[model samples]
Target: MPLSLLLSLLAPPLCLACGAAAQVHQPLCGRCRGGLRWLPPEQAGAGVPLWAAVSYEGPARALVRALKFRGAVALADAMAAQMAANAPPGLLESRALVPVPMHPARRRRRGFNQAKEIAAALGRRCGLPLADCLERPAGAARGSQVGLGREERLSALTGSVRFRRGAAVPLRALLVDDVVTTGATFAACAVALAHAGVRDVGGIAYARTPGR
Candidate 1:
């Protein structure tokens, strides 16, 4: 933990969603995790199968908002753990966990990549290496993830997220992210992996949409 973050925890910041004092250095209170909805990967639609740890409502939603919008990088661990909780057996046994990358401009404006943070945290706890799966170039940075059709958006998104070419090793990967609304982002990352000769890529995330 950063010195500033460590000091902040000693004092204990008040939770935004609830008035309770947060014991964890991250954004959530103990009660919050309970209110969050969790989904397993196999329950998802036809696409890159996703493992969602919590729902997008209640405390999980609040925590995700705090991390993605309020610049709270510290909350990644909670999300990572929750995500790992319901991850596929294949992912748990995999050697690498790759984060779906954000465009540079958006990342710069946000001041952090929540997916990357979650990916690193997941890798640490799961004892796997964290890999970078996608990189949005100079132009493609913005989109309404909600409006896009799962298949269409997945088809249009980052198809060429280059990893190190010609590195010699067996390839079994698990994609990591903060959440999945449409299957778009997960599918995009899956496509990238497929291009890289990784035929089967599993996914894990903080949470997933309940329907569709």
Candidate 2:
């Protein structure tokens, strides 16, 4: 066995996928790594090139669940590290990061926007600014759960999100989120940004549900 492999065999690593105490990277174990479905650039997205750091399995699922359901803001940094490692180098061009916004009512109940929190963390790591360029309707929701077709998703939030009120116009942006189940949501966000006259919209997420 190679010296490194032999050492790993002797030491055994903790399962990074599930926090199981082993001896390797405390977060990602060899088994979990093997199971992770890291996508090639072709599968990420044709127009935007979706960037994902790890497969949504083992610890990755747990981490996303913990962050989303368990209110784990602390996990953002670790997640951001993964983004730093895997995100496209061009993602941070002249554009800043803008996380998909949650409805005010939902955000009020949750006390935070998880996507925004993640974008903030990633923005810090990438040394870029963040912009809240879009908003959901007063009582509407935008996501896979919303049950809207792609065309509807494009204009669903039309009146909801105000245009870029900031001094900057003709800016570029990268939208962020925890997971993308369908291309609908991201495409819709792109539509909204386009309506607002902003060019150059790309996206990044922690995970993507396979297939439509």
Candidate 3:
């Protein structure tokens, strides 16, 4: 048997949010999943138009924390499912999914890029192609944007993100991220893609920080 299958038999998966037993394919228990506060169709107007699946509060917040900080990568699929379902009509169709790039040092320390993982799963569910064409060069300074304001973030991220040297730039691109707080990240990414010849750029995230 595969090692993953054997491990599952020995110790069943547990909910990342509440620690209750969960199915192998699911990261949250039914109750926690049901508790997510689904948001109405709303867009953050900071940079490019962006849609979110749920408010970044309660179970939704917990799930994002688990996936981003606790290494519970399995939750990406569940988060992506919600994003795919809640996406605006025609937003995902015919557009390449571009995961917001992470700084290399941060990605190495975290062992993965949560945005990329979420975007990968979202692509599979939405029938979109993954355009891993954006990147943050190693020369750029890396800092936490946790407490920064929108303008502050934009200033700090300026010139830090760029399109890869020779990757195929899609005609239309939809930026993907695990969370959208002030939309600075999406804006920065959209700018990079636009400079690289992508005509249309939009964004989607699993959760959006409430009140931003």
Candidate closest to the true structure, highest lDDT: 3
Regions of model 2 farther than 4 Å from truth:
1-17, 22-35, 44-49, 141-170
Which digits, one per residue and each the tens of the lDDT, describe model 3 over residues 1-212?
Answer: 86655777899888777899888788788988888887777576575888888989888888899898878676798888887777778887999999999999989999999999998998899889999999999999787888888889898888999999999989999999988888888999998999999999999888888887
**Residue 38, model 2, lDDT:** 63
- Give the true-structure RMSD of model 1: 2.8
- Each candidate's lDDT (Cα)? 0.70, 0.68, 0.87
**Number of clashes found in candidate 1:** 1
For residue 89, what is the lDDT in candidate 2? 61
RMSD after CA superposition, every candidate: 2.8, 7.5, 1.8
Q: Give a tens-digit lDDT track for model 1, residues 1-212.
A: 77757868577776656857776554556676456666645656346666677666777777778789978777788777766666666667755777778778788999888988988988788888876655766566456655767666655675534444554322877777777777677777777677778866877778666565
Superior by TM-score: candidate 2 or candidate 3 = 3
What's the residue-level lDDT of 39 in candidate 2?
51
Better of 1 and 2 by lDDT: 1
Which should have the higher lDDT, number 2 or number 3? Answer: 3
- Per model, state how many residue pairs clash: 1, 10, 0
- Which pairs of residues clash in candidate 2, taking residues 3 or more apart in a chain or in different chains? 12-23, 13-23, 13-24, 14-22, 14-23, 14-24, 16-27, 16-28, 16-29, 17-59
**Candidate 3 steric clashes:** 0
